[model samples]
Target: MPLALYLLALAVFAMGTSEFMLAGLVPEIAAGLDVSVGSAGLLTSAFAAGMILGAPVMAAFARPWPARSMLLGCLMIFTMCHVIAALTPSFAVLFATRLVAAMANAGFLAVALRTATRLVAPDRKGRALAILLSGTTIAIVAGVPAGSLLGTALGWRATFWAVAVLCLPAAVGIATGIRPAGRTSLGEPDHEPSLRAELAQLRTPHVLIAMLLGALVNGGTFAAFTYLAPVVTATAGLDPVWVPVALMLFGTGSFAGIVVAGRLSDAHPRLVLGIASPVLFAGWLILALCAARPVLLLSLIIVQGVLAFAVGGTLIARVLYAASAAPTMGGSYATAALNLGAAAGPAIGALALAGHDELAPVWVAAVLTGTATLMVLPSLRLIAPRAHRVAPTG
Candidate 1:
C-alpha cells in the first residue's frame, strides 16, 4: 500500500487513455489533417512499434538508474509529447509525437512493474501488479469514452491537451510520494542491475513459457478488442450506440478479471492459469461461431474480456516470478512480450478484415488463444508463487 505505487498507476492511466483514445478519434483526426482514415490508423501502428522496440532498449539503458528517477523522467517526456501533439496541426508532427510518447510509455511500464513488486512483499507481487494494471483496465472502461466525448464537445486536440494535463498530478505525486534515490520506495538492490544477467533468464524453462503464454493470450485479446466496433454493430446488427456500451462492458469485465486473478493467483496460480487459458480460447471460439446472434455476441464479449485478462495478467506476473533473479530485465521481458502480442494480434485481425468480414477477427482471436492453450503445459511450474523463498536479511 505504498503511495508511490498508486502514483505510478495514475501515470499509467493517463498514458493508457492516450494509447486507446485514438480509436474514437481516428475519423476526426483524419478529417482535420486532410488524411484518410487508413493513414490515421497507422499512428496506432507507430505507437505499437515504439512500445515493442523501445521497452527492452529503454529498460537496458536505464537499468542502472534508480527506478524512481526513471519513472519520473518517462512521465515528463510523455507529458511533453502530448503537449506537442496537441499543438501540432500537421499529421507528421502528430505521428512523431505518438511514437515518442509510446517509448516513454513503454519505459514507464517496464520500470513500474519492477518497482511495484519491490514495494510489496514477495508473496503480494501479484496484487501489487494488479493494482498498477487496474489503471489500464479502468482507462479502457472510462478514459477512452471520456476522451471521445471531450473530443466531440471540443476537438481532438482538446483530448491531447487533457492527457497532458492529466500527467501533472501524477508527476507531483511521484515527486513527493516516492522517497529519494537511495533506499527509496524502490527498495535498494544489493548490486547494480545487469542486462546480461537479465537476458540469461530467457533460457530458463519457466520464463520462456510464461513469455509465450503472455504473447499468445494477449494477442488474442487485442485481436478481438481492436475490432469490437465492427463485430458488435456491423456483424451482430446492433445499433451504433452499442459500440461504446460494449466497450464499457468489456473493460468492466477486464477490471474484474485482473482483480480476481491478483487475489487468487498467489494462492492458486496454477489453477487460475489452467482454467482461464482454455476457457478464454473457448469463449473466443463460441463468439466466432455465434457472432451473428445478438444475445450471444453481447454476452460472450464480457466473458471473453474476463478470461482474456485473467489468463494474460497472471502469465505476465509469472514472467516476473520466474525471472525474479533478474529484476531489471524481468519487467522488460513482460513488457516486450505483451507488446509483441499487441502488435501481432491486430495485424492478424487487419489481414482477416481485408479478406473476410468483421467476424474474421474473432476467428483469428480463437486461433491465437487456442495455440496458447496448447503451450500451457510447459509453463505450469513457473506460474506459481514460490513456496519456499527466504526473505533477504541485512
Candidate 2:
C-alpha cells in the first residue's frame, strides 16, 4: 500500500473517533449543558442523519474537483467544526456543529475511498479499501476508549479539542503525501461524468442491491451491538467490568476480520459475503439462545464480530465494482447506505427491547443478517449479465 493510503486511513481514524466518542461522553455533555441525557443523545442521531443526507450531496458537488482537493477541503471543514464544537456553550450550537462535522466527515470518506481505489490496481482495490477502513476499526479498538478516558480526566470539551488537534496531522499528510495526478488515471481527467449520468448509475439493479446489502449488514450488526452491554450484564450474568473487555475482544475480531476479508475480496467478493452473512446470522442466533450462559455469550460475541466485519470490505468493493461507471457517487451511496443502517439498527433494536427481553436484539440481528445472506445470491445473479456492459471508471 502507498503512504497516501495510510494518510487516508489517518483521516478516517480522526473522523471515526469523533463519530463514536460521543457515546461515552453523553452524560458529561448532558451535565455540562444542563440537558437531559436523552437530549444529549440527539447529538449522535444528528451526526448519523447528516451522514445519511450529506453523502450524495457532497459527491454530486465534488464531481468536478480532484479527489485530493475534496478530501483536504473536507478535513479542513471537519477540523474547524470540531474546534467550534469544543468551544460552544449552548447545546443547540454543539448539536449543529456535530451535524456539520458529520457532513464533512461523509465527504471525506466518500472521496477517500474513491481516491484509495484509484491508487491501486483493479484487483487490489479491495485491499486498498480495507486498509483505509481499518482506521475505523482501529478507532473503535483504541480511539473511542482513549477519548472516553480523556473525557473523564479532562472534560468532554477537551476530548473534542484533542480530536481537532489530531486532524491537523491528517490534513498535512494528505496535502503532502497524495499527488494531484495520483487522484485518478490520466484518462479520467478528460471524461468527467455529469451529475445526471452519475445519478443514473444508481438505477442499476446490482448497484441498488449492493447498497441494500451494505445497509442490512451494518443494521444487523449494530442492532445487536447497540444493546450488548445490558445483554452481557443482565442476560449473561457477567460482571459489569467485563463489558469493556468484551467490546475490546469484539473490536480485535473486527480488525482481524477486515484484513482477512480484504485478501479474500480480491478473488472472491461474492464468497466473502456468502460466508459472512451465514456465519453472522448463526453467531447472532447462538448469542440469543445462550445469553444466559456467560462463557457461551462471550465466545459468541467475538465470533460474531469476526463474521460481521468480514463482509465489510466485500460489501464496499461490491458497491464500487457494481457502479464502476460512476465510482464517486457509488462510493458515496455506499457510505450513505451504511450510515442509514447504523441509524436504523438501533431503532430496530430499541423496538425489540420494548418486549423487555435483553436477548431480543440478538434475535433481531440474526433475522436482519439472514435477510442479507438471502440477498447475496440474487444480487450476484443480477450482476452477471450486466458485468460486461458497465465500463470501469475512477
Please provide TM-scores, in order, for all candidate models, with all chains considered together: 0.95, 0.95
Q: How many residue pairs clash in each candidate?
A: 0, 0
lDDT of 2: 0.83
Per-residue lDDT over 64-162 for candidate 2, one digit per residue giving the tens place of the 0 to 100 score: 787878999999999999999999899999999999999999988888878888888766777888899899888888898889889999999999999
Q: How accurate is candidate 1 locally (lDDT)?
A: 0.86
Name model 1 segments beyond 4 Å from true. Answer: 184-189, 385-394
lDDT of 1 at 203: 81
The ten-residue window of minimal lDDT in model 2 covers 385-394
Instruction: Supply candidate 2's per-residue lDDT for 374.
Output: 85
Give a tens-digit lDDT track for model 1, residues 1-394. 8877889899989988998999999999999999999999999999999998878888887777888788899999999999999898899999999899999999989988988888887777778888898899999999999999999999999999999999999999888887656654244366754677778788877777788889998898999999999988888899999999999989999999889878876667778877878888889888988988989888898888788988888888878777787878788889988899999999999998986888888888999999988888555654563572421111
Query: In model 1, what are the clashing residue pairs, if there are any?
Result: none
